[model samples]
Target: MYKLSPFTYTFAGRSKAKKIFLDSTLIFERNDTVAIIGPSGGGKSTFLKILKGIIPEYSSGKLEGEVLFNGHPLSGVYFQENLQKILYLFQNPFSQLIYPGTEEEFLFSMENFNFTREQMDREKEKFEKLFNLKNIWGKKTSELSNGECQKLVLASMLAIGPDVLLLDEPTAFLDPTARKEFYQYLDVIRKDRLLIIVDHHVDEIRPLINKVIFVDHDGHITPGFFTKNNFVVEDISLPKPKTAEEVNVTVSDLSFSYHKDRELLKEANATFKSGEVVAVRGRNGEGKSTFFKLLSGILKPKKGQILLEKNGKTYKNDKIFPHVGFVFQNPEAHFFFDTIEEELKQSFRFLSKEHTVLKDDLLSRFFHDIDLKKSPFLLSEGEKRRLSILMTVFLEKSLILYDEPTFGQDQKSIEEIIVLIRELKKLGLIQVFISHDDYLIEKIADRVLVLEAGRLYEVPRA
Candidate 1:
């Protein structure tokens, strides 16, 4: 079912008009599975955007790319012409649920894409049996977790039968077990369509990768099957964002509970210090986020107390954010504006106008630091996550608390985030990252704390 002619494309990132390509020029027929790998900020996400048409059109940074379908260019190719032929899975799965309530609407979307009534009837059973969506059949897309919603999106994508499938860091936020299952879906689809992926954990997914396209740190992309030469990323080095130093956060006998329920957290005693990126890890429902709430002043601890030590003053947990920056897991939950500019400007109001110069100085620190006026909410999920982190930095906080930052990011987004955290840490920000990523714990955290039930690991280990 492969079409002839060339499957070529081109694109760029940032305000600079220089074109960059991982596989700068790619010619593939149907059933070709390609993986784009590179260091952080290498434009993996940008490449996917070009393919998704988010680039050059809705995408910013002076786009100069062309994506063709069936030997025909996509310039005037409306989505309706091939709506059933392509589905793009962004890094953040939460924001992709744009349809009405219920899974029925989702199935109806598939029908709109030319899925037959018969295909619709057996779609749930077929998709569920393949990707495990039996329980999600009736659930609202909004209610599903990133992992669950991603699975549903994948199932729906498969049910609709797109000629080309693009997945942007689909498993970057998933746990090890969840990652393995996600790869199975990729393997299933690689056999029949043109599958292009932007990812970093290619070591674990090497077998699924039929070809590898690499984008180095400078946005230079080299494409081909994996070889010793393909792994060369001269600019891919760790950014030392923090220094090993004294503790900045002190949690003494911290206890919290929701209403009258069994204490969700009990006697949590831990101290987050400087010169170290401390990681907090635990199973879900262990009050990990609640602890963050207490530290950020979003929630008050019921029993014990938490204090943030800054410049010799001990501030209460409720007042942490005024001095410390905290980025919530769901940054959208805090957003009321419809545009990125409004969001930033509104948030800046928290600081007085007398500090206006300071505010502009801070906005320059957003990792984007370039063009930030595009549709903020309309940006990809990974991009939104980056903005959230960047906005926290713009606050110029003495301490930063990140909760599940990688929750729904693709590989490129996670890597950029890891770099951003290091840069901010080097600038003397005490960051506390909460996650279950062992690799992140090893790469960024100077100290790793595991929470078993309600207890924090106290012993330091190499």
Candidate 2:
């Protein structure tokens, strides 16, 4: 059992320090499976870190009140004794997966708890079977896909037999089928343990969750019941195409492979027209990100041509950089400036040389509540995503490629993105994005491209 009595946390800021948690009280029993819901940058992740005793130890913050574990205060001796019994999984698996190979990572976690060789092997086999990670046992961690990384981290955590499991967006990167499998596995394994999940996919996991806690913008926590009506997705309308037959980019006989034995894309072909939103949908590790990289000139095809046709001129893959803008799946990787404002200004400088620069008021409207002076690296995951997309849109590229645009966003942020997409389409810009969000694809996509068995097939919009 765990208890937090009138807990409060604060972080350093420019004018004044900001309070992330405002004297909140929460309790978790042995068999509780609770879901945390909130808006983007609403301190859900911070609350989890606080519960795990990470805020005062690893971060510079002001903390008050007591966090007790099993009727004892969490201190040096108590925390060290119960370290193996509590586990916290980060939102990004890359932070938790430190070992080079999967096998070493799994073994290292088990050995930390003094598991014998035989016990380690037994637990490793059980977890591998449970998470379906046999195919990636020998692969390097860097080479695994996002979903694969998530599975590996989860397996490693479960191998230790923790009494409490704190997962932050465990299925944010998974495809639909993989997410269902993960949830089913979690449901079976978390029967006796305390499981706390902070996720935006409320509707998908409603059946498995026992209680729901809402963290509002003011850092107040309120308990509620789970309901299917919590999420209401509306159908978004996009602008009509200027010319239905105008092809902006054409991929012909494209072939690519990360390894010699595994071909991710082979002889794939597709066409994207102007003034349209094209969604690329497929299973996890099915070359959706690979296709986006190829289109953005980040990776070149081994055999075939990717042509960008604009103003009666054709540009090949290597020459298409000027017309293409790419927003990576991890938005933190796209930042290069010291501050958020500098990052946006850098994009504007690259786009124009004259006085037609983007105004601060317009930029402020796009990032309504974010601090412009903060470092891009310090922003929350959702804030980083919005900044990344804003920079890409400022470039005014003829072709925009977004990979998982709504990964950690809340409902309001998603609605803002839909409006931005509509405005972009009205400007005759070609938009092609990879997403697992069915609602987004159904609402905004004019055409949906399904990548399967190394081929791109068109599916009718719903």
Candidate 3:
């Protein structure tokens, strides 16, 4: 059986990431379908990167200990060549996708793996139907949404026939039905490959995993906590606020025609309250993220405006960001920090606590826990996800908007997020969540707002 032993990794020294977060005492062996779960700053992703031999090799970092492949210590080995059998599927499928290449170019990656005209047609018919990807096969990869792109990536990975597949929050953006379908496919996927999934939707995933490795904010990996037969269901208390009757968000006669297409938001009008958490859901190309952008001032509304009501004052467009903090699904996309600590500092600026006044103990604990001194960009997908959330939460804005916070979390980490959200809501921070997690809605969202064909509608409580 394959194995990894006494593994340790740290990022390039940066004052920002002085933390020595991960100290994994346990070893990972074959036949162990380990699910690493933990808080946002926890070292879940870092652990996976080290195992994949990306750390200190493809990446520049300080690494200690050896990762044994069948009792043979192969630490800092030729990671890419050695681990060809292990595929590290990125969190965002689009990032891994070569944008400039055509679909045919992408499909036939290996020069030798060619398709005879007939075989190509047959393969197309099967995969297109299987993945619902018929329409965009000839189009550019940039044209696809997060969900559609993910299905394509999955199709490609399955084709490679890897021995182990490491996925990061693979279903964060998919609808509940699509999310279910993806996991069901993974559980029965033809390969005997040991599956290491770092996901956030635990309710849907709990049944499939073999064992769980629970990690804390301190980056401690404790394996074999929960297994298939040892599943324990816990009732989580989340901070779901009472819905207010007054209109908090008003979209008045919002109409937009993008690139000569029909109106995206055709005179869409709606109202939201401070305590309400609305989820925008629809098929890809339906303007989910677009609606968020309109509200956040990245894209000005073509016709109508998203009016935020704060202390009885109606603020429009750019005026609302200060009142409401938005946590993008890819927080790293906007982060220009040289180190994690700098990013933390920037986030802390929004806090009521003075910069010098912020607790050093908490900072110390955070750095030590998350290993923040390391190169933040070099972190694994899951680690990046957590760090982004931690930065947003630290901002302590009146309103917090999360595109998809739980996308790349394992079952345990998902639960921890639920707990944290509940606690934050108890503090009366306005939360606007755009997510597909039914479990998250049940726990944290007091009201659900669904977007259909770029139109926004609210699902009232029964």
Best by TM-score: 2
List the RMSD of every prediction in angstroms.
6.6, 3.2, 5.5
What's the lDDT for all of these models? 0.64, 0.81, 0.63
Off by over 4 Å in 3: 5-42, 62-84, 100-121, 135-144, 211-247, 261-264, 283-285, 310-313, 317-323, 353-375, 378-383, 390-399, 409-430, 460-462
The residue-by-residue lDDT of candidate 1 on 370-404, one tens digit each, is: 34554565444555666677667656667788877
- Identify the candidate with maximal lDDT: 2
For model 2, residues 203-317, the per-residue Cα lDDT tens digits are 8888888878888766676776654333443433333434533448899999998888878898999988888899999987688888888998888899898999887898999
Candidate 3: minimum summed lDDT over ten consecutive residues — where? Answer: 229-238
Locate the minimum summed-lDDT window of 10 residues in model 1: 229-238
Error of 3 at 155 (Å): 2.2
| Candidate 2: Cα lDDT at 277 | 95
User: Residue 434 error for model 3, in Å?
Assistant: 0.7
Q: Regarding lDDT, does 1 or 2 come out ahead?
A: 2
